[model samples]
Target: MKRIYLLLTTFSLLLLQACNSFFDQMPDDQLTLDLVFQSKQYSEEFLAHAYSYVRDEADRKGGVPFDPLSDDFDVPYSESPAYPLNIGNWNAASGNYNFWQDYYRGIRQATYFILHIDENRELQGMAGGPQLIKQYKAEARFLRAFFYFNLLRQYGPVILIGDEIIESDLDGNDPKMNLPRTPYDACVDYIVSELDLAATDLPLHFTAQSERDYGRATKIACMAVKSRLLLYAASPQFNGNTEYVDVVNPDGTPLFNTQYNATKWERAAKAAKDLIDLDILGLYKVAGDDGNIDPYRSYRDIFLTPWNNEVLFARKSSDLGWPYEKHTAPRPIGGWPSYSITQQLVDAYETASGKRIDEPGTDYVENGFSQADGTYTEAGTYMMYVNREPRFYVTVLYNGSYYPSRVNGDQRMEFFRTGSSGRDGARDYPHTGYIVGKNISPNSDVRNSQFISRPYVLYRYAEVLLSYVEALNESSPGHPDIATYLNAIRERAGLPGVPQSLGQSEMRERIRHERRIELAIENLRWSDTRRWKIADQTDGGEFWGMNTGAGTSLHDPAYYQRTVFERRVFRKEYYLFPIPQSEMDRNSNLVQNPGW
Candidate 1:
């Protein structure tokens, strides 16, 4: 039995050249192209190296990670991307920290792998030679599709470069050299078609009877991508988006269709339903945790358990050391105190019985210190925090909330003015009087250097369930499966089932709200707001935080009040990120995104 890469890829087993400026340029000091594939290790090493291009959601050194980018949270630092983006200071020149070049480089690498893999004499000579080679081809193709989907998700329509290399410059002056942007729908079809071909060669799941190939791409992975891609294409952002009507190719060919396609939603729903039908994945439930479902354990363990059943696709390695906790937790316990939870997101969670506070005939409060339902004991605590959803307790760490940190000698988090981890002690304390609780494991002890590595999930069963519910409601209008899937998530979160009387319009809001709370800090909020065409509404407004501006003292109730920290302004141009000007200068066939 061959040892699989702990990260699901052997890329990290050996360090490779970081730069891919000229992917085709041969290294003068290394193995020759002919000799490289002669050995299985060298060949597998090259293929494994390409896996690093996959996105990392928990990379905080990349500057405040994804959680703070949306209105859900705010970081205290003014130098980070979130701050500049929040204040409307990002421009094409500055904001364009684009991935177009790097992704194309990865695609080129995958193409190279597919083209040269047949030269592997070792693999070709095996008893399973033909089957192994076929799997390799499928892997390369799936990776190529994955790269393209990443580009599509971020930059929208992009040129679909096939598996052939051209002997020409990539600069703007050569019209014959540059590939024009493929139409949005065409790009979607090409990606799906590629996955369809690759899936025939991939397995559903690795059988326990076999000791090899645990983390490789599978039939289910391809289906999930197809579902997510179709979901995006069918969304309001890409489906019949009139904003791109004037945005077309230089030859006057339309890239984004102006007419809405209702069938696309049906296709999305069907695709997601297929993945759900597989039955291998589901909302992760903790067995023997009592009927009162430990929502915290159920939710937190999604990212903690090694290759847990909930994870569909993830980075199965812990490359960084306790970074998630360090970035989100407070200061007294070796935390950065940077990532802070916002009042907006705090208000989104419903009561334990699944009722929104602002809804008619409900007893929930958004403000003031009243101890609404005796969920916990604290003096003059915010009434808004009591009797809220279990997810709210699992997520937000308010001033009075008790949270134990294994890294800090099992010490709990303290967030008031005079508390150990309060604003009075540190200059970089949380901007809002709250911290996020989802990403860190309760057993992780950074203080003792007892580190644990678990897969960082990019796609999970719960997301698929939610996506299916959202699409089903949109397509068939109040479909019953919508309630079935949505209620599954709610029940796991220790909440009652939703009212069956909820119609499509009402269900839509319910679905969105559920996603907002459930998927918070998982890098979905930014895209969700954009795809739902609610960025302008959700993004533009005053951002609130507990008073860091003019609080008199710990005795000041004004210090406990929600104060306006920063006013965020989002523009229409922000709907699509700007293609870096360097790429535009290099490839004239490229057009900048709207208002860039």
Candidate 2:
């Protein structure tokens, strides 16, 4: 892969532009790339720069909010970048959340680090010696592979630049600079192989003496990434889909495989099973006084607890401490409360009896108020929110929900027209009459000026388990392990095991529904809906919620009824994000996606 050295003047210009901050500040005598790589400290700094492009999952106000793009939530501000996309204003020219350029810049940084890190001799006499150099190079490899996975999932097939760091003095018209996009399956295989090689050199777990290295790449991180990548490759969007059969390069190279392959599912299942066989991780749990697992605390604390057994990958530092919590807090307690959940997500939660609200014997009531349920709600709580699953109580904040605050003396939230979190000005209310409860710490109080410091999880054991079952069902449906692992997830949530009578089709829908509830607001729903080829059915047309326009009191009938808040457009072309128009203009080898 390193033999093919192809770098264009366009790539050079972008590379120089992206590296100005790292390369320009020093005196001319010390600023050369060779001089920077010769020092051990500077080489470490460059490795850190390679990881600077990882998306902050806790970010809500800055980059694209993925939850709003799916059917799970609505961004109330018209100024949001996702608003144009939701209303059908998206195009190839649309620059909303364009990561194509950012990720390639990261790839170039990591590639340069991998190529030049061996030049530093100071590392040879250090604590870990030349083997430490090998480990550093492997970390760079993992980062490069991670960036390619993000690119492939969003833009489909992309140009794989491999391990070469070419420097050319020729004109910008060189044909080597204009390589065509690699085929999708080939890209998957290359990334998987890179991860496999990286896993060999990375530590399975960092020692307590090296506690500062908690969030760096590890052998398990590599395996976790491979599982997710193969699962996407085996999905309906990329596997045997006739929609992209005509998406070929200018020289007649097919960029997508149109033939269905059941073996891809088998490969995905094996990747997940390989990780599960390690036996080092399990679902994070907390026990009640009676020694039974407390489902509510277990689910709620997964995000708040740092470096727990449940987290396979996490970011140590982020800007989500107070601002993120403040946004989800009720406005009466000094919060913005504009980020709200959708009724579609509210309806997805099963009753405490492990049954859908519409299912028989669910005992679901939607019309009146109820006495305090002793947990999750208080006296006079709305009947619509009563007797729901523990995860629902942990994840959704509704009208009349009890909120605990050290400064506000434990108040109840109100979302009526004249209430605390109701429709006020443009930016202070929830348009859907609900607030996001997941990921916000229970101890955080905006009015008290207190926030919880915690790590943001990137991957966890539960997601890998879910992916394992999903892939196994597709490849070998009714395999006993499918029910065994699926039951593991269900039982942790305090629900009973799934019925063994369910066939493949019934089990498939069941797995998808569980994913929507378990992985909601974790930044996976947008891709999950797209890969399953069901975005048009789930994300199109009118969206409903509690009536935010009416309701002046706590029990207002008008406020309790479901009403349409926004209507969205989801076309077939929206399934694959368009290749940014600027990329096509800059490189002649690049072609626009269909219907962009």
Candidate 3:
């Protein structure tokens, strides 16, 4: 495990050198087989290359931001992938913003690394020779499995290329070169097995003494991935999905298993429990000097602080004025407004007392607007945004909200029309009339003297807890542990626990809403909806936004209503993203998903 300090600087140079191999018949700049095994530094460099694609969640620079595709947020700009996905303009070739080729290239590199690292003479007789080599091999395997998991989850059943790299001059006539799509369940099994191997060799945790080892594959990361992967395998969207009944291979065999497997729920529950029972991590609680826990600070800082105990896995971004801050921060304080929170997402958070607004016993009421076709009729004041969940205050920023701190002398976020920063204030404006508060760090604004970048949290303890509860409910309807885990999250968010009488069906809804609100803006909503096979119901609706267009001035109350933003179209066939035609064309054995 290499600390990610000045190495990322050299990694950029290595990437450039690797790119030089493309055109030159023989390029010294390339990461050749010889270059990797030269020393521990060089070997670790290659591992770092593989580590770059660990899917840390938010990468605006990567051209594929998944947050905008879901109903939680609306990306009004047409140039982004979000716009096309929202409008249903994407397809196998046309609307495709998928990561197939990049991830496959990573898989190839990882497989090649695993296959050759043992034979490196330099590594054989080094200071930490045997242990280092073993760790390297394990790291590479972890990466290989991780990349494969990413592919399988996105494209459903895909070919398991294994630890063999195709030579540049390989013969096309070889049957082994062109592999058929493996069964979806088989892919899951293979990935889980690889993770199991990885977990055995990896360390349980990284001490501050070895802080540079922070981002590398650890035992907990491997276990966490296994938990998530198994949960997906056990989900209704894949376990027994009738939607993919026709998703078959070129040889006419079903790709996805349509048979419901009850024991899979048990497997998922146990996997999540294994991670939790390790007891090394917890829902972050900010403690006062007097030892009182500040639930709000704890919940908010889980994202703000890097490598906090709550973070199961993360990628720390160099505070080099990263654009994630600039995008989510409003233009009133130098933000790009790339991701605007939706009205529906704002409504999803339970009241501070932990009751749904629509439920009978909640203090929060849905009162802003009334309409027939749309909700923005006779507009009311912004009072409805008040007294919601503690998480809500930390997640969504609206008309009268203030910044976490002063920036360039601005404190209150004046989002009303024609205010210092409003709809017409800058070129970058929130289309939904609400900014994403969750991703914006308190010190990330340009108004501050210095920037603070949080580790891009990929997996966390809260998600693990929710996964356990979900599996428990699916397997045992009224498991006693369900309320304990569910309320643990709620308690950390400054809310009460669940009601004792809550049934399985309502608890299922509770779990989904908890994920939506808890993992808000983490780019998990799209995947969650897909796995639950509820995209048609969850996504295919009229997207709503605060009606900031009804008046040119803040004096008019009509501008404060919930209005239709865009009518989304989610097809049942869209449950599985289409495998690119280019991939299918290249391999005769590769089968397209159920729908293109």
Candidate 4:
């Protein structure tokens, strides 16, 4: 096994060299391939490292930032400074390159393993020998599928490179070296097949190796991914478009000869149903006295709990360890103060009855909540409404909600006095006002400075259930089963079930709305918007904040005037991120996506 690890490490080094010329001059002291594949342990470790590449921070940086580029919700001016360029404009030349490179890096490692693992006949002598090789291949395929899915989501029609491409082939000397974009359908087919291959070998759950392999890929994870990819492919954005009929094969013939088949929807439904039948995963239901349930509690807990059967796959990080939480948490009291949940996102939450605050008979002025809609009531004071939906309380932190430290359970309510002095004494403290809620751990013993590693869940059981319901609705429109699925989600969230009187369109709207609130800030919104073709909804806008300083003067305009253009609204061209110009320049065979 050690030999195999050395071989893989050596191969990875070679691949790294291939990535840039810097490593090319290094000595060939690295272990030979012959020495590495001799043992199963070594092979497994190599594959695990390859898996680690999928969730690496470098890969996450590009993808995670791109998430807000969708329509489900918007971030205020406060969060805009994080990535001013990408959020302010649809342009993502540098960001896309980063994403493309990281995905291909993982893909290359996977291809190397698939191409080599079978040749070693010595594997027959090891425990699980050929089966182990097959399993590893399956895992690699799964990772490949995941990367491809991400690429397709961002770039739309991308060049599909299944195997490692030799530099010589793309020396600008070979005609076949330059490949044009694959049709959207072709790319989807490739991803679907890869997931199918992966599902055949991965276990539904990890039972053999406990803690170490807990969050690794599994059969169910592969299925969840496939179901998600196919549903997106079949959506209006790609499948419903007739212009792409021969986009890849402009010669009056289909390049991949793929069609926008309705059967794809059925296939997605079946995949989702298969996962449900596995019975190992299901909705995290929280029942209410009046049968009004709130799914938010279950959803919130899913992120905090490790080895949760609900989480299919996740990127492990400590509690305060995740840089996102560390940076976003209130600084001085916490870490690098960054991304904050905006007032816009907070206001989107509905009351326990699933009604918006502005709805008729909602008692807006009496509740002290100002209606941003601008319709003034007789009451001079804006009511601060409370006790709406259970989820409203579970996920949001309003004016008076407790602001506990993510590390220690220390409450910031007292320390955040209105008259606190500024760090420089010349100006007042910026964050000495309100704090957000939900993501922070309420454990009082743990301080905000403590580093706690909590795994970042990529796919969880709640999503599995939601995906099943979504696929079922799309595949069988108006199917009676829609209510069953929709109600399950609502009931879990302490909300009333959808009335049977609602039409198909209304139900679909409700489902879309539910998904938006249910999955907000978990990093699914960006792709969700792309697949739904709603990028135009994210017009760049200012992030707002309240003025809380040393003075008690509420009339000062500067206190409420701080705003930043953190989000760029969506334009049609923003639907599919432009293919990096660098890649287009190097490969003549590459064609730019439409509207680039």
Question: lDDT for every model?
Answer: 0.73, 0.81, 0.73, 0.56
How far off is residue 293 in model 2, in Å?
0.7
Model 1 lowest lDDT segment of ten:
1-10
Q: What are the TM-scores, per candidate, against the unseen true structure?
A: 0.90, 0.93, 0.90, 0.80
Residues 287-325, candidate 3, lDDT per residue (tens digit)?
857786666677778877778788887664432245556
Candidate 1 overall Cα lDDT vs. reference?
0.73
Query: How well does candidate 4 match the true structure in TM-score terms?
Result: 0.80
Report the C-alpha lDDT of model 4 over 1-596, residue by residue, as the tens digit: 32333333444543322222211222233545564456455555456556655543212223355543443223223334224544544354654334666666667667767777787667867677878678778888888888888778767766677865344324574755676777778788898888888888877676544565655668877887887787777676776665444444333334333345677667777777777788777665544465643355565666566666676776543223444444334433543332344554555667656776677865322233443432111222124334455555555443334454534543322112242222223221233233334555544223244444566667766665667667777777777767777777677776778776676677777777778777666667677766666655543455433434333332223333223424344456666666777777777767665566
- Estimate the TM-score for candidate 1: 0.90
Q: Candidate 3, which segments miss by more than 4 Å at Cα?
A: 1-31, 60-62, 171-173, 288-291, 318-321, 365-381, 406-409, 445-450, 551-555
Measured with C-alpha atoms, the lDDT of residue 8 in candidate 1 is 24
Backbone clash numbers for all candidates listed: 1, 0, 3, 50
Q: After superposing candidate 2 on the true structure, give the runs of residues whose Cα lies further than 4 Å from its correct spot.
A: 1-30, 166-170, 206-209, 372-374, 404-409, 448-450
RMSD of 2: 4.2
What clash pairs does model 3 have?
Answer: 3-212, 90-95, 91-95
Quote the positional error of residue 7 for candidate 2 in Å. Answer: 17
Name every residue pair that clashes in candidate 1: 172-586
| Candidate 3 TM-score, true structure as reference | 0.90
